[model samples]
Target: MAKQSSNRATQVIEAVGSFLRRCIGSILSAGPIPKHIAFIMDGNRRYAKKQNLEEGAGHRFGYSTLMNMLKYCYELDVKYVTIYAFSIENFKRRPEEVQSTMQLIQEKIEGLIEKESIVNRYGVRVHFIGNLKLLSKPVQLAAERAMNATWHNSKAVLSICIAYTSTDEIVNAVEESCKEKQKGNEKLLDEIGEGPLIDVADVEKHMYMAVAPDPDIIIRTSGETRLSNFLLWQSARSLLYSPGVLWPEIGFWHLVRAVLDFQKNYAYTEKKSKES
Candidate 1:
Protein backbone atom coordinates (compact mmCIF):
# COMPACT_ATOMS: atom_id res chain seq x y z
CA MET A 1 0.00 0.00 0.00
CA ALA A 2 2.85 2.38 0.81
CA LYS A 3 4.53 1.68 -2.54
CA GLN A 4 1.27 2.23 -4.42
CA SER A 5 0.75 5.52 -2.60
CA SER A 6 4.28 6.57 -3.48
CA ASN A 7 3.67 5.81 -7.14
CA ARG A 8 0.46 7.83 -7.07
CA ALA A 9 2.28 10.77 -5.55
CA THR A 10 4.93 10.58 -8.28
CA GLN A 11 2.27 10.69 -10.95
CA VAL A 12 0.66 13.73 -9.38
CA ILE A 13 4.01 15.50 -9.10
CA GLU A 14 4.84 14.80 -12.75
CA ALA A 15 1.47 16.14 -13.86
CA VAL A 16 1.96 19.31 -11.89
CA GLY A 17 5.44 19.75 -13.32
CA SER A 18 4.08 19.46 -16.83
CA PHE A 19 1.45 22.13 -16.12
CA LEU A 20 4.02 24.51 -14.67
CA ARG A 21 6.38 24.03 -17.61
CA ARG A 22 3.63 24.87 -20.09
CA CYS A 23 2.72 28.03 -18.22
CA ILE A 24 6.34 29.12 -18.08
CA GLY A 25 6.91 28.31 -21.73
CA SER A 26 3.96 30.37 -22.86
CA ILE A 27 5.34 33.34 -20.96
CA LEU A 28 8.86 32.95 -22.35
CA SER A 29 7.85 32.62 -26.00
CA ALA A 30 8.18 36.16 -27.45
CA GLY A 31 9.83 35.86 -30.85
CA PRO A 32 8.43 35.03 -34.27
CA ILE A 33 6.68 31.64 -34.10
CA PRO A 34 7.01 28.85 -36.62
CA LYS A 35 4.19 28.60 -39.12
CA HIS A 36 4.49 24.83 -39.45
CA ILE A 37 5.76 22.13 -37.08
CA ALA A 38 6.18 18.39 -37.42
CA PHE A 39 6.64 15.75 -34.76
CA ILE A 40 8.12 12.26 -34.75
CA MET A 41 6.56 10.87 -31.60
CA ASP A 42 8.91 8.05 -30.64
CA GLY A 43 9.48 5.69 -27.66
CA ASN A 44 5.94 4.76 -26.70
CA ARG A 45 6.82 1.24 -25.54
CA ARG A 46 9.87 2.49 -23.70
CA TYR A 47 7.74 5.05 -21.94
CA ALA A 48 5.26 2.33 -20.97
CA LYS A 49 8.03 0.16 -19.52
CA LYS A 50 9.50 3.08 -17.59
CA GLN A 51 6.13 4.03 -16.13
CA ASN A 52 5.15 0.42 -15.30
CA LEU A 53 2.12 0.81 -17.48
CA GLU A 54 0.58 -1.34 -20.19
CA GLU A 55 1.63 -0.85 -23.82
CA GLY A 56 -1.78 0.46 -24.83
CA ALA A 57 -1.73 2.84 -21.87
CA GLY A 58 1.44 4.48 -23.23
CA HIS A 59 -0.21 5.08 -26.61
CA ARG A 60 -3.29 6.45 -24.86
CA PHE A 61 -1.10 8.86 -22.94
CA GLY A 62 0.61 9.83 -26.20
CA TYR A 63 -2.78 10.72 -27.65
CA SER A 64 -3.47 13.00 -24.71
CA THR A 65 -0.05 14.58 -25.06
CA LEU A 66 -0.66 15.21 -28.76
CA MET A 67 -3.92 16.98 -27.95
CA ASN A 68 -2.22 19.19 -25.39
CA MET A 69 0.65 19.95 -27.73
CA LEU A 70 -1.80 20.89 -30.46
CA LYS A 71 -3.50 23.29 -28.09
CA TYR A 72 -0.17 24.94 -27.41
CA CYS A 73 0.68 25.13 -31.12
CA TYR A 74 -2.68 26.75 -31.79
CA GLU A 75 -1.98 29.25 -29.04
CA LEU A 76 1.31 30.06 -30.77
CA ASP A 77 -0.58 30.68 -34.03
CA VAL A 78 1.02 27.81 -35.90
CA LYS A 79 -0.92 27.14 -39.08
CA TYR A 80 0.26 23.63 -39.85
CA VAL A 81 1.16 20.58 -37.72
CA THR A 82 2.18 17.15 -38.92
CA ILE A 83 2.67 14.06 -36.76
CA TYR A 84 4.28 10.77 -37.66
CA ALA A 85 1.73 8.53 -36.05
CA PHE A 86 2.69 5.29 -37.77
CA SER A 87 5.30 4.30 -40.31
CA ILE A 88 5.25 1.60 -42.95
CA GLU A 89 8.12 -0.02 -41.05
CA ASN A 90 6.03 -0.10 -37.89
CA PHE A 91 3.87 -2.81 -39.46
CA LYS A 92 6.69 -5.27 -38.66
CA ARG A 93 5.87 -5.05 -34.97
CA ARG A 94 3.93 -7.80 -33.19
CA PRO A 95 0.54 -8.41 -34.77
CA GLU A 96 -1.30 -7.63 -31.56
CA GLU A 97 0.46 -4.31 -31.19
CA VAL A 98 -0.32 -3.34 -34.79
CA GLN A 99 -3.98 -4.24 -34.24
CA SER A 100 -4.16 -2.10 -31.12
CA THR A 101 -2.56 0.81 -32.94
CA MET A 102 -5.09 0.54 -35.75
CA GLN A 103 -7.92 0.63 -33.27
CA LEU A 104 -6.43 3.65 -31.55
CA ILE A 105 -6.04 5.44 -34.88
CA GLN A 106 -9.64 4.78 -35.75
CA GLU A 107 -10.78 6.18 -32.42
CA LYS A 108 -8.66 9.30 -32.86
CA ILE A 109 -9.96 9.88 -36.39
CA GLU A 110 -13.54 9.59 -35.20
CA GLY A 111 -12.82 11.86 -32.28
CA LEU A 112 -11.47 14.49 -34.65
CA ILE A 113 -14.89 14.67 -36.27
CA GLU A 114 -16.67 15.11 -32.96
CA LYS A 115 -18.51 18.37 -32.42
CA GLU A 116 -16.31 19.41 -29.50
CA SER A 117 -12.99 18.36 -31.04
CA ILE A 118 -10.39 20.99 -31.94
CA VAL A 119 -11.12 20.31 -35.60
CA ASN A 120 -14.57 21.79 -35.22
CA ARG A 121 -13.89 24.31 -32.49
CA TYR A 122 -10.85 25.94 -34.10
CA GLY A 123 -11.68 25.19 -37.74
CA VAL A 124 -8.64 22.94 -38.01
CA ARG A 125 -8.34 20.86 -41.15
CA VAL A 126 -7.30 17.22 -40.72
CA HIS A 127 -5.39 15.32 -43.38
CA PHE A 128 -4.00 11.78 -43.55
CA ILE A 129 -0.79 11.34 -45.51
CA GLY A 130 0.11 7.74 -46.39
CA ASN A 131 -1.00 4.60 -48.17
CA LEU A 132 -4.61 4.26 -47.19
CA LYS A 133 -4.81 0.80 -48.74
CA LEU A 134 -2.64 -0.56 -45.91
CA LEU A 135 -5.05 0.54 -43.20
CA SER A 136 -8.05 -1.47 -42.10
CA LYS A 137 -11.27 -0.65 -43.93
CA PRO A 138 -12.87 1.02 -40.93
CA VAL A 139 -9.79 3.06 -40.10
CA GLN A 140 -9.36 4.14 -43.70
CA LEU A 141 -12.99 5.18 -43.85
CA ALA A 142 -12.65 7.14 -40.65
CA ALA A 143 -9.58 8.94 -41.95
CA GLU A 144 -11.39 9.87 -45.15
CA ARG A 145 -14.37 11.10 -43.17
CA ALA A 146 -12.20 13.24 -40.97
CA MET A 147 -10.45 14.77 -43.97
CA ASN A 148 -13.68 15.49 -45.78
CA ALA A 149 -15.37 16.88 -42.69
CA THR A 150 -12.70 19.52 -42.15
CA TRP A 151 -11.66 20.14 -45.76
CA HIS A 152 -12.96 23.68 -45.77
CA ASN A 153 -11.25 24.82 -42.60
CA SER A 154 -8.55 27.46 -43.17
CA LYS A 155 -7.45 28.35 -39.67
CA ALA A 156 -5.11 25.38 -39.12
CA VAL A 157 -4.19 22.03 -40.64
CA LEU A 158 -3.21 18.82 -38.90
CA SER A 159 -1.62 16.04 -40.91
CA ILE A 160 -1.30 12.53 -39.48
CA CYS A 161 0.98 10.06 -41.21
CA ILE A 162 -0.41 6.56 -41.08
CA ALA A 163 1.56 3.77 -42.78
CA TYR A 164 3.71 6.45 -44.35
CA THR A 165 7.15 6.00 -45.86
CA SER A 166 9.04 8.66 -47.76
CA THR A 167 10.53 6.14 -50.14
CA ASP A 168 7.21 4.49 -50.78
CA GLU A 169 5.59 7.83 -51.39
CA ILE A 170 8.28 8.75 -53.90
CA VAL A 171 7.93 5.43 -55.70
CA ASN A 172 4.14 5.75 -55.81
CA ALA A 173 4.39 9.23 -57.21
CA VAL A 174 6.74 8.06 -59.94
CA GLU A 175 4.40 5.25 -60.86
CA GLU A 176 1.51 7.67 -61.07
CA SER A 177 3.45 10.00 -63.30
CA CYS A 178 4.42 7.13 -65.59
CA LYS A 179 0.81 6.07 -65.94
CA GLU A 180 -0.26 9.59 -66.79
CA LYS A 181 2.55 10.00 -69.31
CA GLN A 182 1.80 6.64 -70.90
CA LYS A 183 -1.67 7.72 -71.99
CA GLY A 184 -0.49 11.03 -73.44
CA ASN A 185 2.91 10.01 -74.82
CA GLU A 186 2.12 6.85 -76.71
CA LYS A 187 5.05 7.27 -79.13
CA LEU A 188 7.48 8.11 -76.30
CA LEU A 189 6.13 5.26 -74.20
CA ASP A 190 6.74 2.79 -77.07
CA GLU A 191 10.31 4.12 -77.58
CA ILE A 192 11.32 4.29 -73.92
CA GLY A 193 9.71 1.03 -72.73
CA GLU A 194 7.87 0.60 -69.39
CA GLY A 195 10.33 2.25 -67.03
CA PRO A 196 8.95 4.85 -64.62
CA LEU A 197 10.75 8.11 -65.41
CA ILE A 198 9.61 11.16 -63.47
CA ASP A 199 11.24 14.40 -62.44
CA VAL A 200 11.53 15.49 -58.81
CA ALA A 201 8.91 18.15 -59.42
CA ASP A 202 6.52 15.55 -60.83
CA VAL A 203 6.91 13.42 -57.71
CA GLU A 204 6.51 16.44 -55.45
CA LYS A 205 3.28 17.35 -57.19
CA HIS A 206 1.84 13.92 -56.41
CA MET A 207 2.94 13.55 -52.80
CA TYR A 208 0.23 13.31 -50.16
CA MET A 209 1.43 16.53 -48.59
CA ALA A 210 1.56 18.49 -51.84
CA VAL A 211 -0.81 21.17 -50.60
CA ALA A 212 1.01 21.97 -47.36
CA PRO A 213 4.26 23.92 -47.18
CA ASP A 214 7.40 22.18 -45.94
CA PRO A 215 7.65 21.98 -42.17
CA ASP A 216 9.63 24.77 -40.55
CA ILE A 217 10.63 22.59 -37.60
CA ILE A 218 10.73 18.85 -37.00
CA ILE A 219 10.84 17.61 -33.39
CA ARG A 220 11.72 14.07 -32.46
CA THR A 221 11.21 12.92 -28.89
CA SER A 222 13.17 10.34 -26.87
CA GLY A 223 16.45 11.86 -28.09
CA GLU A 224 16.34 10.21 -31.51
CA THR A 225 18.47 12.17 -33.96
CA ARG A 226 17.74 10.12 -37.06
CA LEU A 227 14.96 11.06 -39.44
CA SER A 228 13.78 7.41 -39.60
CA ASN A 229 12.35 8.01 -43.11
CA PHE A 230 9.92 10.77 -42.21
CA LEU A 231 9.43 13.61 -44.76
CA LEU A 232 12.72 13.24 -46.61
CA TRP A 233 11.83 15.72 -49.32
CA GLN A 234 9.95 18.28 -47.27
CA SER A 235 12.36 18.35 -44.30
CA ALA A 236 15.44 19.28 -46.28
CA ARG A 237 15.48 22.83 -44.86
CA SER A 238 13.66 22.09 -41.62
CA LEU A 239 15.14 22.82 -38.21
CA LEU A 240 15.35 19.60 -36.16
CA TYR A 241 14.88 19.34 -32.40
CA SER A 242 15.59 16.15 -30.49
CA PRO A 243 14.46 16.17 -26.88
CA GLY A 244 15.22 13.31 -24.51
CA VAL A 245 11.67 13.20 -23.21
CA LEU A 246 9.46 10.35 -24.40
CA TRP A 247 6.35 11.02 -26.46
CA PRO A 248 3.97 10.45 -23.58
CA GLU A 249 6.00 12.86 -21.43
CA ILE A 250 6.36 15.71 -23.95
CA GLY A 251 4.75 19.08 -23.28
CA PHE A 252 4.60 22.67 -24.54
CA TRP A 253 7.92 23.74 -22.95
CA HIS A 254 9.88 21.34 -25.13
CA LEU A 255 8.22 22.80 -28.22
CA VAL A 256 8.84 26.35 -27.06
CA ARG A 257 12.52 25.59 -26.46
CA ALA A 258 12.81 24.12 -29.96
CA VAL A 259 11.27 27.23 -31.50
CA LEU A 260 13.66 29.48 -29.59
CA ASP A 261 16.62 27.40 -30.72
CA PHE A 262 15.38 27.67 -34.30
CA GLN A 263 15.07 31.44 -33.99
CA LYS A 264 18.66 31.78 -32.79
CA ASN A 265 20.03 29.59 -35.58
CA TYR A 266 17.93 31.25 -38.26
CA ALA A 267 19.06 34.71 -37.20
CA TYR A 268 22.72 33.67 -37.21
CA THR A 269 22.46 32.06 -40.67
CA GLU A 270 20.60 35.05 -42.09
CA LYS A 271 23.21 37.52 -40.83
CA LYS A 272 26.11 35.38 -42.07
CA SER A 273 24.57 35.09 -45.55
CA LYS A 274 24.04 38.87 -45.76
CA GLU A 275 27.67 39.53 -44.80
CA SER A 276 28.90 37.09 -47.47
Candidate 2:
Protein backbone atom coordinates (compact mmCIF):
# COMPACT_ATOMS: atom_id res chain seq x y z
CA MET A 1 0.00 0.00 0.00
CA ALA A 2 2.85 2.43 0.84
CA LYS A 3 4.67 1.65 -2.42
CA GLN A 4 1.46 2.27 -4.37
CA SER A 5 1.01 5.67 -2.76
CA SER A 6 4.64 6.61 -3.55
CA ASN A 7 4.18 5.58 -7.18
CA ARG A 8 1.01 7.66 -7.44
CA ALA A 9 2.78 10.70 -6.00
CA THR A 10 5.69 10.29 -8.39
CA GLN A 11 3.36 10.15 -11.35
CA VAL A 12 1.59 13.31 -10.25
CA ILE A 13 4.87 15.17 -9.86
CA GLU A 14 6.05 14.09 -13.29
CA ALA A 15 2.80 15.20 -14.92
CA VAL A 16 3.03 18.60 -13.31
CA GLY A 17 6.65 18.97 -14.39
CA SER A 18 5.82 18.06 -17.98
CA PHE A 19 3.02 20.61 -18.09
CA LEU A 20 5.29 23.31 -16.68
CA ARG A 21 7.97 22.55 -19.25
CA ARG A 22 5.49 22.85 -22.10
CA CYS A 23 4.29 26.22 -20.85
CA ILE A 24 7.87 27.47 -20.56
CA GLY A 25 8.86 26.11 -23.92
CA SER A 26 5.94 27.86 -25.59
CA ILE A 27 6.88 31.18 -24.02
CA LEU A 28 10.48 30.84 -25.10
CA SER A 29 9.46 29.88 -28.62
CA ALA A 30 8.24 33.43 -29.11
CA GLY A 31 11.83 34.66 -29.23
CA PRO A 32 14.87 33.58 -31.23
CA ILE A 33 15.87 29.94 -30.88
CA PRO A 34 19.33 28.66 -31.72
CA LYS A 35 19.56 26.47 -34.81
CA HIS A 36 22.59 24.65 -33.47
CA ILE A 37 24.03 24.16 -30.01
CA ALA A 38 27.20 22.37 -28.92
CA PHE A 39 27.97 20.91 -25.54
CA ILE A 40 31.25 20.14 -23.76
CA MET A 41 29.97 17.64 -21.25
CA ASP A 42 32.38 18.03 -18.35
CA GLY A 43 32.83 16.89 -14.74
CA ASN A 44 31.63 13.30 -14.72
CA ARG A 45 34.51 12.11 -12.59
CA ARG A 46 34.19 15.02 -10.22
CA TYR A 47 30.48 14.41 -9.87
CA ALA A 48 31.04 10.75 -9.10
CA LYS A 49 33.64 11.56 -6.47
CA LYS A 50 31.36 14.09 -4.85
CA GLN A 51 28.50 11.60 -4.72
CA ASN A 52 30.70 8.72 -3.44
CA LEU A 53 30.08 6.59 -6.51
CA GLU A 54 32.32 4.78 -8.94
CA GLU A 55 33.85 6.89 -11.70
CA GLY A 56 32.14 4.81 -14.34
CA ALA A 57 28.82 5.40 -12.61
CA GLY A 58 29.29 9.13 -13.15
CA HIS A 59 29.56 8.60 -16.89
CA ARG A 60 26.42 6.47 -16.81
CA PHE A 61 24.56 9.21 -15.01
CA GLY A 62 25.97 11.76 -17.43
CA TYR A 63 24.64 9.75 -20.36
CA SER A 64 21.18 9.83 -18.84
CA THR A 65 21.49 13.60 -18.53
CA LEU A 66 22.60 13.82 -22.16
CA MET A 67 19.48 11.96 -23.32
CA ASN A 68 17.28 14.32 -21.31
CA MET A 69 19.12 17.32 -22.77
CA LEU A 70 18.64 15.98 -26.29
CA LYS A 71 14.90 15.57 -25.75
CA TYR A 72 14.70 19.12 -24.40
CA CYS A 73 16.69 20.55 -27.33
CA TYR A 74 14.57 18.70 -29.89
CA GLU A 75 11.39 19.80 -28.12
CA LEU A 76 12.59 23.37 -28.47
CA ASP A 77 12.91 22.73 -32.21
CA VAL A 78 16.68 23.10 -32.34
CA LYS A 79 17.76 21.60 -35.68
CA TYR A 80 21.30 20.56 -34.84
CA VAL A 81 22.94 19.35 -31.64
CA THR A 82 26.61 18.45 -31.16
CA ILE A 83 28.34 16.87 -28.18
CA TYR A 84 32.01 16.54 -27.33
CA ALA A 85 31.72 12.92 -26.33
CA PHE A 86 35.43 12.06 -26.21
CA SER A 87 38.66 13.92 -27.02
CA ILE A 88 41.88 12.61 -28.49
CA GLU A 89 43.66 13.62 -25.28
CA ASN A 90 41.33 11.44 -23.25
CA PHE A 91 42.96 8.35 -24.71
CA LYS A 92 45.99 9.05 -22.53
CA ARG A 93 44.06 8.32 -19.34
CA ARG A 94 44.70 5.23 -17.23
CA PRO A 95 44.39 2.03 -19.24
CA GLU A 96 41.63 0.55 -17.12
CA GLU A 97 39.65 3.79 -17.08
CA VAL A 98 39.92 4.12 -20.84
CA GLN A 99 38.75 0.55 -21.35
CA SER A 100 35.80 1.06 -19.05
CA THR A 101 34.76 4.24 -20.84
CA MET A 102 35.09 2.54 -24.22
CA GLN A 103 32.89 -0.33 -23.08
CA LEU A 104 30.24 2.02 -21.76
CA ILE A 105 30.33 4.11 -24.95
CA GLN A 106 29.93 1.01 -27.08
CA GLU A 107 26.92 -0.10 -25.07
CA LYS A 108 25.10 3.25 -25.17
CA ILE A 109 25.88 3.84 -28.85
CA GLU A 110 24.33 0.51 -29.74
CA GLY A 111 21.27 1.40 -27.70
CA LEU A 112 20.82 4.70 -29.58
CA ILE A 113 19.73 2.87 -32.71
CA GLU A 114 16.91 0.99 -31.03
CA LYS A 115 13.47 1.64 -32.47
CA GLU A 116 12.18 3.37 -29.33
CA SER A 117 15.38 5.31 -28.60
CA ILE A 118 15.49 9.11 -28.61
CA VAL A 119 17.21 9.13 -32.03
CA ASN A 120 14.11 7.54 -33.56
CA ARG A 121 11.65 9.24 -31.21
CA TYR A 122 12.68 12.66 -32.58
CA GLY A 123 13.70 11.60 -36.09
CA VAL A 124 17.28 12.67 -35.40
CA ARG A 125 19.91 11.63 -37.93
CA VAL A 126 23.06 10.59 -36.12
CA HIS A 127 26.53 11.52 -37.38
CA PHE A 128 29.74 10.45 -35.77
CA ILE A 129 32.07 13.39 -36.32
CA GLY A 130 35.82 13.03 -35.78
CA ASN A 131 38.81 10.87 -36.64
CA LEU A 132 36.87 7.65 -36.60
CA LYS A 133 39.93 5.64 -37.60
CA LEU A 134 41.26 6.09 -34.06
CA LEU A 135 38.33 4.13 -32.63
CA SER A 136 38.42 0.39 -32.08
CA LYS A 137 37.02 -1.83 -34.81
CA PRO A 138 33.88 -2.68 -32.81
CA VAL A 139 33.24 0.95 -31.96
CA GLN A 140 33.84 2.01 -35.54
CA LEU A 141 31.39 -0.63 -36.73
CA ALA A 142 28.79 0.44 -34.18
CA ALA A 143 29.13 4.08 -35.19
CA GLU A 144 28.83 3.20 -38.87
CA ARG A 145 25.72 1.18 -38.09
CA ALA A 146 24.14 4.02 -36.18
CA MET A 147 24.77 6.45 -39.03
CA ASN A 148 23.39 3.98 -41.56
CA ALA A 149 20.34 3.30 -39.43
CA THR A 150 19.43 6.96 -39.12
CA TRP A 151 20.19 7.88 -42.74
CA HIS A 152 16.49 8.30 -43.52
CA ASN A 153 15.55 10.66 -40.69
CA SER A 154 15.63 14.34 -41.66
CA LYS A 155 13.95 16.27 -38.90
CA ALA A 156 17.20 17.04 -37.07
CA VAL A 157 20.88 16.06 -36.63
CA LEU A 158 22.91 14.76 -33.70
CA SER A 159 26.70 15.05 -34.07
CA ILE A 160 28.76 13.02 -31.65
CA CYS A 161 32.47 13.93 -31.54
CA ILE A 162 34.64 11.06 -30.42
CA ALA A 163 38.43 10.97 -30.66
CA TYR A 164 38.20 14.58 -31.79
CA THR A 165 40.25 17.70 -31.28
CA SER A 166 40.12 21.06 -32.98
CA THR A 167 43.75 21.02 -34.10
CA ASP A 168 43.50 17.54 -35.57
CA GLU A 169 40.29 18.37 -37.38
CA ILE A 170 41.84 21.49 -38.88
CA VAL A 171 44.97 19.68 -40.04
CA ASN A 172 42.98 16.86 -41.57
CA ALA A 173 40.67 19.25 -43.37
CA VAL A 174 43.55 21.24 -44.83
CA GLU A 175 45.39 18.11 -45.96
CA GLU A 176 42.32 16.64 -47.61
CA SER A 177 41.60 19.91 -49.39
CA CYS A 178 45.17 20.06 -50.67
CA LYS A 179 45.05 16.48 -51.84
CA GLU A 180 41.87 17.13 -53.79
CA LYS A 181 43.38 20.19 -55.44
CA GLN A 182 46.55 18.28 -56.32
CA LYS A 183 44.71 15.36 -57.87
CA GLY A 184 45.23 14.86 -61.67
CA ASN A 185 47.58 17.89 -61.70
CA GLU A 186 50.40 16.83 -59.46
CA LYS A 187 52.83 19.12 -61.36
CA LEU A 188 50.41 21.96 -62.12
CA LEU A 189 51.80 24.17 -59.36
CA ASP A 190 55.41 23.56 -60.52
CA GLU A 191 54.64 24.11 -64.19
CA ILE A 192 52.45 27.18 -63.68
CA GLY A 193 54.71 28.52 -60.86
CA GLU A 194 51.57 29.01 -58.77
CA GLY A 195 48.57 27.20 -57.36
CA PRO A 196 45.15 28.22 -56.24
CA LEU A 197 45.25 29.46 -52.67
CA ILE A 198 43.32 27.34 -50.18
CA ASP A 199 40.57 29.60 -48.85
CA VAL A 200 38.34 29.25 -45.81
CA ALA A 201 35.71 27.66 -47.97
CA ASP A 202 38.01 24.89 -49.05
CA VAL A 203 39.03 24.04 -45.48
CA GLU A 204 35.50 24.26 -44.15
CA LYS A 205 34.10 22.07 -46.88
CA HIS A 206 36.40 19.24 -45.80
CA MET A 207 35.75 19.59 -42.06
CA TYR A 208 34.12 16.73 -40.17
CA MET A 209 31.60 19.25 -38.87
CA ALA A 210 30.65 20.43 -42.34
CA VAL A 211 27.29 18.68 -42.13
CA ALA A 212 26.05 21.13 -39.47
CA PRO A 213 26.17 24.90 -39.37
CA ASP A 214 28.32 26.72 -36.88
CA PRO A 215 26.85 26.49 -33.39
CA ASP A 216 24.94 29.53 -32.18
CA ILE A 217 25.69 28.65 -28.60
CA ILE A 218 28.37 26.49 -26.95
CA ILE A 219 27.65 25.36 -23.39
CA ARG A 220 30.32 23.90 -21.14
CA THR A 221 29.16 22.61 -17.78
CA SER A 222 31.08 22.51 -14.46
CA GLY A 223 31.60 26.26 -14.57
CA GLU A 224 34.39 25.94 -17.12
CA THR A 225 35.11 28.98 -19.26
CA ARG A 226 37.56 27.34 -21.65
CA LEU A 227 36.65 25.80 -24.98
CA SER A 228 39.09 22.93 -24.28
CA ASN A 229 39.78 22.38 -27.99
CA PHE A 230 36.22 21.35 -28.69
CA LEU A 231 35.39 23.47 -31.79
CA LEU A 232 37.93 26.19 -32.28
CA TRP A 233 37.31 26.65 -35.99
CA GLN A 234 33.52 26.67 -35.74
CA SER A 235 33.09 28.70 -32.54
CA ALA A 236 34.71 31.91 -33.68
CA ARG A 237 31.47 33.84 -33.18
CA SER A 238 29.46 31.54 -30.90
CA LEU A 239 28.10 32.49 -27.50
CA LEU A 240 29.64 30.52 -24.64
CA TYR A 241 27.55 29.56 -21.61
CA SER A 242 28.88 27.83 -18.51
CA PRO A 243 26.68 26.73 -15.66
CA GLY A 244 28.06 25.79 -12.26
CA VAL A 245 26.52 22.35 -12.08
CA LEU A 246 28.33 19.18 -13.15
CA TRP A 247 27.25 17.24 -16.21
CA PRO A 248 25.15 14.68 -14.33
CA GLU A 249 23.53 17.38 -12.21
CA ILE A 250 22.64 19.60 -15.15
CA GLY A 251 18.87 19.97 -15.35
CA PHE A 252 16.20 21.54 -17.51
CA TRP A 253 16.50 24.89 -15.78
CA HIS A 254 20.16 25.19 -16.82
CA LEU A 255 19.24 24.76 -20.47
CA VAL A 256 16.44 27.26 -20.07
CA ARG A 257 18.85 29.74 -18.56
CA ALA A 258 21.31 29.30 -21.43
CA VAL A 259 18.63 29.82 -24.02
CA LEU A 260 17.30 32.84 -22.19
CA ASP A 261 20.78 34.30 -22.05
CA PHE A 262 21.24 33.68 -25.74
CA GLN A 263 17.98 35.44 -26.53
CA LYS A 264 18.88 38.38 -24.35
CA ASN A 265 22.07 38.97 -26.29
CA TYR A 266 20.81 38.00 -29.70
CA ALA A 267 21.52 41.39 -31.19
CA TYR A 268 25.13 41.48 -30.03
CA THR A 269 25.69 37.91 -31.15
CA GLU A 270 24.21 38.66 -34.54
CA LYS A 271 26.32 41.75 -35.04
CA LYS A 272 29.50 39.92 -34.12
CA SER A 273 28.64 37.06 -36.44
CA LYS A 274 28.04 39.46 -39.29
CA GLU A 275 31.29 41.25 -38.64
CA SER A 276 33.08 37.91 -38.73
Best by TM-score: 2
Measured by lDDT, the strongest candidate is 2
Candidate 1: worst-modelled 10 consecutive residues by lDDT: 22-31
lDDT of 1 by residue, 1-276 (tens): 999999999999978976876676566566667878999999888989999997788999999999988987886778999999999999999999999999998998899999899778878999899998999999999999999999999899999989999888888888887777667676875676676466677778888888689888999999999999999988877889999999989986798788888777878645664685
Please, what is the whole-model Cα lDDT of each candidate in the order they appear? 0.87, 0.94
| RMSD per model, one decimal | 5.5, 1.6
Residue 148 in model 2: shift from native, Å? Answer: 0.6
Clashing pairs in 2: none
Clashes of 1: 0
Q: How far is candidate 1 from the true structure (C-alpha RMSD, Å)?
A: 5.5
lDDT score, candidate 1, position 59 = 92
Stretches of model 2 off by over 4 angstroms after superposition: 1-5, 190-196
The alpha-carbon deviation from the true structure for residue 222 of candidate 2, after best TM-score superposition, in angstroms, is 0.9
